[model samples]
Target: MADQQTLQKMRQLVDQLNEYNYHYYALDNPQVPDGEYDRLYDELTALEAATGTWLPDSPTRRVGTEPVSAFESHQHLAPLWSLDKVKTEEELINWETRLHRQLGDLANDSLEYMLEYKYDGLTINLTYENGLLVQAATRGNGETGEAILAQVKTIGAVPLSIPYQGTLEVQGEGVMRLSIFEAYNKTAQEPLKNPRNGAAGALRNLNPQVTASRRLDLFCYQVGYCSDREFESHEAMLAFLRENRFPVSPHLRKAAGIEAVAREIRQMEAGIPQLDVLVDGVVVKLNRYDLRQEAGFTMKFPRWAVAFKFEAMEVTTRLEDVVWQVGRTGKLTPAAELTPVEVGGVTVRRATLNNFDDIQRKGLQKDCLVWLRRSNDVIPEIMGVADEPDAACSPIEKPHHCPACGSEVVEKGAHLFCPNTLACKPQLVAGLAHYAGRDAMDIDGFSEKTAALLFDALDLRSIHQLYRLKLEALLPLEGFQQKKAENLMQAIEASKHRSLSRFLYALGIPNVGKRTAGDLADHYGSLERVMAATTEELVALPEIGAIVAESITTFFGEERVREAIDALLQSGVTPESAEESPPHEATAFTGKTVVVTGKLSTFTRQEIKETLAALGARVTDSVSVKTDILLYGEDAGSKLTKAQKLIESGKRSDLLLMDEAAFRRLLSE
Candidate 1:
């Protein structure tokens, strides 16, 4: 237990730290000496580690675990399809060549491309019902997603309602400004590690009140499903979304060819930092909708549009040392402490080595020169060791035991885990922190520091003890203001009404991510039913493989887990059941394989895919002899020719071509 003196000292540290952060990040002014700041931070880290009690807003909790299980599948009213990727000028030229080959003499004398910044953030689909903002969901599995309407409503820049009367599907990236992240950090609160995380966390908040305060913003880029109005080109679509009061990125540009598109990408990369939001790459799309249809689409991405990822920022640095850090998942990852070097645009000092296998594969060692790169503002990663190294350099070795708990570590594939999951303090504390994270249960005000403090200071074990906390008892503890204490309790209380899918996700069951959680909820209806299911029963469900089924069953079988569920129930955490669906029935297209290629004049690619799925057809991106139908849209390409060949060979009678009118009728039936 923390003594009174230690608690008091911690409070002072928090206040002082917050002030320093506010100055450095928010105001770009330093109040305290860097040495002094480091000293205080180190002291706090040590104290928290020693005493096991942490303040809620400590900085150490930023890099969270929960390797995004599967993204919840969301059936976008408009499909959130990916733009194809291109690496070199040759590929871009080849695309242009293909366009000319298909169009022949009719190929427009001049084709234009629309280039825009590809904001590196979560993709969200916003639905406006009768001019009123009604729903927002992530592009999960391109099919379904968690409803994050409450959190999305908090973003001041996102209009609560648009002026349009017709149903509209607006697709955009939810973004956070670097300036805001810095400002938030300067307030002595934890600084967001990156804009993507900041935006994701803000948009997933259970409390719109908290999300509203974060100043998150959006830039709508596409019109998914539109009831009325026609756009002739990609440029027109951008103008439409903007005219409809959707915030569009200002860096949008029109280019004539691959050269112009490449130049635009370069310009954007050079000037991205000056923009309000972070951008990872550039998106280039065929301007004319007719051209887009002609170009058609691959299985996963559109043929007419492509996302050109900027070259990863890389630099050569010395691998000074390697260290092991235990995460909330009890997975021990290796981190390299490097001699400071500049990569891309940022100074780099550290990089993640992944695990033991990665270390061995990379042949990393002390004093060895290594190339490091950062992809999408994530942690810098060691690319490879330099060809030449000092002869005196020593190789880095992996540890056999856990650093925190001294438990024997075992390698599971490429990852190393502490088998002593129940007893490891770091794992326990990390798990609790993840459970209360914004994307999970989103127990606001329950920061990592606070969770640590509660765990160490109060002997709190499971998430259940959190509910037993009284404001009066908390007030006496370090850094607990009466208002803050009350707010924390209220947040916890509010989380009881959290969605059943989110609750299951927050449980952090192995192999069961957000997408799997939604599927389980849809299948079983409630948590109780899921818990009651056996491994065999779970495996019988769609997409639940034996590995995932075993993990789910094992998680439920644990006594500690059972006790945690009981505690949550006692705290009045009621899980709402998922709405029931009609019984499964046979469909006309059942057991048939359908491939959609090129652009359909009748519907967007997403709509066609979803319609086919509804009709019980397995819609594939590629064409083969097994394919029963190849839905030919305008400007059908090589895939269309392939389908014709199959027809000529008398191999298939199911090859069908439907124009806009015919396809609409098919869907209506």
Candidate 2:
């Protein structure tokens, strides 16, 4: 047993570490250096070891435990309800009108509305008893959820104990920050396509370690059940949550009229890009608890509140069929052939199903109305089934063989791959095209058709074979005149002296994108060093994860890859090392929101966007209240008009309108 003085020291260390954690994780403000915190943590850990005991609220509990076989079902003290949603201002007005009619005698009474962001992440219900966190669960079917106390404990922001002594059930959304999401995707083996999915997948993982790795945060929004207290209004409940040291959103607003509520919603939509988490829309609810009680509940949702959703990013469409496409890696990916529907002003005819496991998880079937979402101009993705499949709907069949090469497929993790790498036409064509892409080697005129022609006619079986091409052989090909052949040969020769980063990207390494490839090139400074790097060395880098490290090592270890690399080097290919540049300095654009409009003479859309990003600017596609600068070029369009209107209305007084010349001056300065 520890002496009183020793025990006191342990208590002090526990409290200090917890406070530091709260500051760093919950508030994004570090109160102590990592080294100092580590020292205190070590002291506490040592004391626990010596005494064979630890406090219930000790931060050491956060290191996580072994994987659980399964999650037990937990019944909530109070039921969680789903909210009704509306898309348009007219529908919102109708909802308010209905509320006024329901009030009847109090129709003339002034009503107040509470507004909050509708976070697009997994919903969680936490149960606390006698000031200690007793249980945590998903909002599964409202009444019952899978117990995830172990997983929830791994989240540093989540309180292990609170001030209140009575039992309480608090509701919040579990979300992964967009910044963290981007960092994680840099080296994730199967990169998470969505932040919501990242949070949801992490929380449900059998291993608590997996949950901890995601670094999810929770935003408490409601007290579902409180044994010893009752709140007068929604604002009061939020105050109570804040008092309890819970992480609450800072954007809560109260409005007296429907017009004010609508204005708040518009502002919220405009400021979406500034947020660190995904939010679908704004949630509006009655302010007073008494009014909520009077309004009562419907069968599915509370009558007092409704979610005012933004314009539809997701729409229901029939999945007409599933097509398996082979990539450069020979991996087979399922693509959904959808009955065409408009989403975010674009017509979407197809969506990515990801893999066979994804299809099974989403319960997608042919002829079903599935919800497809398109965001950030990426390929549309099927979120889930919107409705039950009719009898005519058939289960999506997984391919047993490669669709393109007719080779027997091999299962690797959640995906299927073709074993016949050399003979696969689709794989060779894709690989060749990828190597010649502007981002890879800047090889001009090397289209997919050209790749196919070379493969079919000249028996070009490998990437290294491209260097073996001669003018006489190329002259016999369909599109190769003497001048064209000479230009093609010159382009191919020029690619040999490309940067090491581009060469790395052109290698078609699994899980490696341009960013990760650049990171590898920068870290190693040479192809030989990167190829020879051990898994431990690779994993030591901040951006590289265990799976990605293993992938790099495995790819380099393959005999075929080694031989191909050697052949390329022997054919006079010399990839130059990365050029060191000065660290990025803060500029007028740094940490500011920028939106570009119209065609530019100096830079293409992609070029300008990349430049802004390099200078630390958050480039968005739309004009918003939070936008700092609108860079306009020739024939500026609606975005320019919107920015002008915002400025004229004094909604965005600080917003700047910069023409090409002005932007150039700012860059120079």
Candidate 3:
């Protein structure tokens, strides 16, 4: 046993390391060096091994003792549900036949299946008292779990309080997208292995502050208990959860039978990356409550629902070489050059190493035999190296200097950055390309390839120079037609009159996304006012936090940025604020929240949202009691039913259903 003094030192070391780990892993920034962090981590591991009194809170416990080579044991509350697995149409037909055999004549009754994206994340149970969130527990050894209420609350999509003042038990999965995970990993300084790992880490975090930074989102798919209401079908249950202001999966659809379910699943699989969150498979559930009860639980899993997991996309490929690419922010990222290997029906020759740390962690070497797999059917990544070593292979090393500027690289958390920000050619080119993007200036002929050509051939170093290019200079360049060049020039000229919001968005200020840009534009009314505003003043605005405010201030404070803005202004590219029209007289829908769902024949979703925004109505993505009206269009799925129920219950007074002609007439009024 260690002495008192030794134990005190060990405790102090653990605390310090934990704090730093939280900062590095959770916050994406670290104050300490990698060597120093590793030393402290090693010390803790050695001490814990020697002492044999490992603390429960230790980071070492993150890697659980039981090798989860196969599925881990979980005792689900309602027998952790697993769907009947089916690969082909024949298997599906067999499943239907089995159901008929079990139910006998009951199977002949009209049966329906509710299909939903089997979200790729950790399963969690949320308990609420009087509509206010109380506790969130993970699906641990099934019966009990690590209470992570604090961490769960940090998720913006998870409501702290709901419209219904009733006791409820909500079951859902916390899903993270490939893009979100990539963004989070970029900031975290430690490369997250995959979306599942990222979600698990975010959910299990002890500090709410840590979880809040991760931007983890949730989708409630099931209701275990409800004091005030009961649902007859799985679809109805999901609808009820949404009505209570719960974040439910957006991709849920009610299918008539197995064929429809299969179709929906196929559609979801094809469009996985387009979704806001990650889904590994499709969950098909028996819609009727009676059928669900009849086809009840096994000891470990439910008999009703089955998880039709998508086939794993993995292929062995030869690592030809590694190449480092500089991003717009001057951060160096490594990409693997691989011998072409097909995975997930797509030809794959390249994969992201994520960062220098990832490269080292995987023990990747040149000519190494590596297994590549698409994480969530998107973003091909190197999973692991082969067991047999390649005698000719040499270990890959990160460049000590930036390839673009030849400047010494500086280690900033997980990323190695070139501090020669102004001198980097790639940074300037990328920034210019971003400025000319479709959502920004909307330049017609400015493709990324064209942008590179202009930067290299024309000596155009800044976005400001694009407007000054003479027709003669452009006409001489290879493949430059007179009409195309003139069109490009005209487009640049037209972009000058863009709205303040677009201008703000085009600046590419860190943390100032499209929505934030809109909010800033709305609040400030002009770009000049926003530029003149101090960090304190910016932060004082509603929804604008210190981080965003600081980024804005820092962006404007830069000499290069100021020069670019001034040059653009001088070049006749001016951002003008749209004149505010007189407020409309209070209509029945004024000061209300409304949700529009399903196929709209009169107006597009965008048009409806715009009309609502103009009429002083808050347009939300989902339905709830706060939702004053749910304007239902044709085939308006579960939301329409949910809205009807709320209206019937007298929880909401206004529920309006309109066909195409009626909705068009209402808009006109």
Candidate 4:
């Protein structure tokens, strides 16, 4: 056994190492040289191994562990309520008045407020016990959160071991530096939208390695829970937190009154351009903790704090050029190529013009200044042209031919199509890429370049050719190694067992996106049924219209499409459907034409279908004369009336109309 003195020395070493990590990772200023930190780390690791012990807060754990299947649920030490928001100063005045009303005699004439930038990032709740980081969770539903301990520990700014020994729950945001986000985007095949998105996605990733690679940063905003730590005011708490090496924002300021807060808000808005990362608003929190307790909270937001959100980020940029690119389905899309400009801290270079018709309708011209904006939670796009076109400016004209292969083009609905699927390089390459994408077949090593390489060298024309790829052909490729080639082959083989919906979606069927494919699978119950479905049968289903039905039939009608599917199936691509057995009361609704309407407390529309399917009943979306049973829940509408009409006319002779209560009673049998 190790001596008590040795254990104490080990604890000291651990603390020292964590401090070094903070200096190196967070501050970017290392006090000790790399050799010194490494020597101490190695010593601690050897000592811990010799003693057959592991510390929870050891910096060694920063290297991370095996991937977790899922984030574990954790109850918060205190509820993390969202702040009430105010866009205008008048709303802030009203909020203050409300706060005064709540405090009554306890209200101070002048309340000091701590104001800071409202960061656009994921909220993290960090727990510390005995000066060591114990757990880290997301804000989640406020009362409970998912334990992201592994991913959170990877963040250098988040202290592994602190100076104080209090059980504290610190609330902060996980952020990514704007520079880092841009740098990552430059190398990333699939680029991130913004720093906030990168940070949030990194934190939730199942793999700790992926999180660590993201180089996530942090900012501690508030102290949610602190045992053995008390302060008279919010500013005092922030100061104490900063003293313990937490990177509290230097932008945070204490204002004496509403006027002072207003001045600080103006100053913050002016300083936004100079700051790093995205700051969408300013957060104003009452400095006095006692005042906060008296004022308390609403069901969702805090009464003491309010977020003053800035207007949406908008800018004007010149459309330098327009390029037409072909999609997997040969749809020629026009995209605006712009001189790099920043919108909401994201460097924007390119955005889709949607269609040729939109370009013509908007009179979008090259060399014209366009209003670029990020609104309604979408990527930054050109809202409209701001400046009139100059004599030198040229409007993007509808293309007569494909840009990639110079083949003849034609108008399809509002879009232009190449109709050169047989020989178009872009279409073939795009289709292959889509087939190997994450949401599709999920082939790991196959990229657009690799697909093109195979297409050019080996006459690989279709998706099925991917399954036939061998180790010999991949060995000669520039980056391929023995292991890489083998991994790619394995991944390609593994894709053959994907679900029916995945296969259907992977085929790149017209008018069939991911959700539509899922709906088709759920409704048809198998791949075979979907393939053989008539246009009338497809259009009769909920949400699937005539256009979608026509697209489906048209796609399947193609000889190439049918052959490709056949080839895939022949290559052992077995699309499986999930089938469940009926319960003891399976025969209750057997052979019945059932139609459900309104919202049900007991079951969802999907669950009703699944239950009926197991019982050998036909579940239709709409009420008809053929429907033998009409199950109405709360708020029955047009369908209910239609079903009643059919029943009264003796069209559905044995039609039984019932509510959710009656339906449940029947299930109980």
Candidate 5:
């Protein structure tokens, strides 16, 4: 039934598009005009649409399609922690003070800090082995991520193969260039919302061909895992990366301390108008890699680095109305409904007002003109009223009763609280949503409306009740079919087998995020062990401070929490024991940096690399300053000459040249 003519046409279009992309992006030389390219693209798109035929290299896939049912998880070699963020100089000073406290005598009066612009785009983990790109993943929950190698290889900035024949895992931000983003939006039938979203969406898009078409760029910053390479400092590492033809920031700088870093940040921000892409903030990092190791990390971020976030990008918009929202904890907060204004390229319809105090202080009213700011952050905040004396409308009043549950509202210092946490519509819905969120139970197709329906009709008040949902009960719902019902029940049943780390995170313990949950999982080893942990035991664990210990104990002590666990168990929901993925033995030269000097007679290039991939080895061809082991084989030449010169040099005094028999013995091991 396959159409040969259609397939041939698709291949021809793909080949033509590949050439166009090479000329435009790779060579910066376009053989075809924009109009002519667009016409050809349209024709190919039409042809592909008619037959529903798509090849991996097809250019039309750049537009992308619907999401997959679920994203397959890939465990990271190391956790991708976030950076500690500060919005004010005072906070930055406090962060520096903490760093000083940790460093003590090690603080070099004024240490050198590396400054670089922070991109507001998705973070990616790219791994290379034997010089070929093998794996690419998103920073999902830091430790576990979704593999997107097919899409990542399409990036113009990322090399499919590097010259270095060792294992390397690099971390970077995937971003869209402004000129390309704007041009795509102009021609797109349904335009992208923002630059960050466009960049993230294109990579996560299931169609690799589409991702290739987007022309996304990778800004590699950190080396997560590197073998057969050693650098004295972060700057040295950056230099090595640049030497390998990796895209690095030209604006990278070394500053003395907080003040110097701040000055650099100001310069970067001032020059933002001249740049094409967006930058949310500037990251300040300790220069020395050895110091970075000693500084270590907190539960969330690195102690060696801190991010200075910029103030929100401001724009004026009309305040349509104000609405009070109830959080999962029954806390009441206010948000302003705006007249749909585009702020910093993202459409802003609503902004947080913080609280009733903020609203009263600002004298905010309906139809009032407001100034909205969309900072380096995702959510925009309403700064204050822009119009003088505001628009002619009545001031917002505090509610006597909770809006969701009709319970009497309680007034706290400067906030409102609803006591009926379980019964309140918003709180209950929010709690259920959080419980089923992607990072938690990963329950697919469970929306707020569905939660509300389940709560009202079936009295689904607890997390355990979710597992008790039956197909017969689901059939009475507004939109229910035999196949859909079966799928929902199956998904619910599948969630019972999630790992202990995810289950712990799903419990919603205070101050415990995904990373913290992982720490608990690794320390305790199982859910049962975690439940049995005393406050003293918890506090003793690494990264588990006194406050976190108290929170964990307090959550477990709650009768409601116990009852929920019991019900879940009764419903046959049992989390799997925490298990880490198999570790990769990237190279055979363990504990020693290796430099392959000459030609080898025994093993072919590919065969030797394939063997090295099975062991812990760091193999490089460069005979430079930090090579620990130099292995010269039969018919060896230039690399041998370089190694001999480096051997005479005092910097590489500890370097050792071993016989091939040692490598053979390593192979036996």
Candidate 6:
């Protein structure tokens, strides 16, 4: 048993250390030297080790450890409301106008508003009970979220305890400050694309240790739930948070009217680029709690608040050159090489130009300054010609010959394609890589670089030639050790018996992706049936259109393609028949159209798709108005965005958004 003196010492140390941490992390003001702080921390650690006892708000609990197997669903104490968005000042004014109209007689009363930066990061809800941090969760579908307690604990800015000593839930944005983001990217093997992604990816990462490494910061904005006390206004709640040392944003400003709020938003927009964190917009909220209640809410957004969203960041850069690259399908696409410029903190050197026609339509010329725009962490795109081109600047011309193989380029509709598929080196390499991808043949350790090496070293011109490779031939290639060569050979051998759907997808039929290939495999059940199907027969299927059917028929009719398929079969590539469906009870998902987005810890994309299919769901590659369900996971991107928009717009009223845990529950049912 520990003595009273030792326990008192431990308590004192914890309090002192926590104070130091609050100053350093939350307030950016260090109260003591690093050595002194470490000394106290070590003393506290030793005490805890000796006693086998820990305080509820002990500083030692801050270090992230023990990753959760899966995030359990957490029901929020209060519904986390999403703010309505406005792009223009007029729209912002209209939002206020609507709020006033909703309040009825209260419209005569001057409405006070609070304006703050709309942080561009993942939303987090932190819960505390009896002055100790109890839970942390994502915003998710609002009513419920993925519990991320372990991950949120890693953030130093989040207080472990509050003075109120009551059950409470506070809302915040988990952000990786620009300074930390820059420092991390300097040494990261795969540098983070942007700060927002860095924070989102880290928070959603399954491993708590990975989340700790990113050094995330949180800024508490609203008192989401409070059991013991009620604040009269938003300002009073913010004051209570500040009193408890919560990392609240210092930029929160009070505005008298809609016009004042608009002025504040303009000022905030001007300083957005200079801020330490990414702010996509400024949020304007009604300050009075009663006023907010009177204003009420729409189905998707709170009527009391509106986010004034900024436009996508655009910058001008010289279009140094336009390069045409051959894809896996032998289509030549134009990509612009620009003089590197920073757009929204990410350096942009390359931007998509779509095609030769896009360059002409945009009036782009070599050595011309062009407008580049990037938003929502998407790939930067050349928007238009920013300025007049130099007098001597050359107009981008359509190439008559393929850049890779010097074969004649053919124009089909709006795109250029190389007819010489066999001789084109780029096409062969890309096709080989695609054939060996995880979704295709499930070949491990196969990369585009390896494909290029094989194409150059082994004089390999076709996919079938890979099967003809010998150990002797592979051993002589650059970077090929005996173990690597053996592994590659084994992997190649194992790929022979892959599912017929995989084999069909690996064949790289134009316009036929993995989903289409799976559909074909499921419908035909045999390779011969698929190969022999007429365009009319193919198009009869609900998913298959005339164009897709024509493409499939045209591909199978090619003598060269038929010969290649035969060669692969002769080389011991015997694709397994499609799996027969077993007798099972009908599921709720039966006949439903489902879409999945983002990285899942429980299953790969193909695995999830297959699971959905087995449960009688029709899984699609994209979100649409017809999409019945969207199962989203960590770092969910544009599809999730689009699905949310559709839901908010009431265009897809039946569309349901669920997390992995919800999907698992449905599976058990």
Each model's total of backbone clashes: 20, 0, 6, 0, 8, 0
lDDT of 6 by residue, 603-637 (tens): 76558889998888887655767789999987675
Which prediction has more favorable lDDT, 2 or 3? 2
Give TM-scores for every candidate, taking all chains together and pairing residue i with residue i.
Answer: 0.52, 0.47, 0.60, 0.56, 0.45, 0.51
Residue 193, model 6: Cα distance from true site in angstroms: 16
- Clashes in model 4: which pairs? none
Candidate 5: clashing pairs of residues: 61-210, 62-210, 312-375, 587-615, 587-616, 587-617, 588-617, 589-617
> All candidates: CA RMSD in angstroms?
19.7, 20.8, 13.5, 20.9, 24.2, 21.1
Q: Candidate 2 deviates by what RMSD?
A: 20.8
Candidate 2 lDDT tens digits, 1-669 = 888998889899989888877554333334443335657877897899899878887876552122223567777899888787677899899999999988777655557999999987778899877666767888765777778877887788899778897989999999888888876653343557667778878888755657877889989999999998999999999999998988998889889888889999999888875788878789999998988888898655788999887764767889999999887778887889999998767799988667898898888999998878765344677877888888989999989999998999999888899998888998888788888888788788887789999999998878889999998999988979999999989999999999999999898887676778987998789999999999998886645678889999999999988998999999998989967667678888877889887657677666888999889787765576778999998667567898999999999988999999888887787
Residue 613, candidate 3: Cα error in Å is 13
Worst 10 residues of 5 by lDDT: 60-69
Output the lDDT of residue 50, model 5.
81
- Mind sharing the TM-score for model 1? 0.52
Worst 10 residues of 4 by lDDT: 60-69
Q: Per-residue CA lDDT of candidate 4, range 375-419, in tens?
A: 323346565677788897886777898999999998867878898
Error of 3 at 554 (Å): 3.3
Model 2 clashes, total count: 0
Order the candidate numbers by TM-score, best to worst: 3, 4, 1, 6, 2, 5
User: How well does model 1 score by local distance difference test?
Assistant: 0.72
Of the candidates shown, which would achieve the greatest lDDT relative to the real structure?
2
Clashes of 4: 0
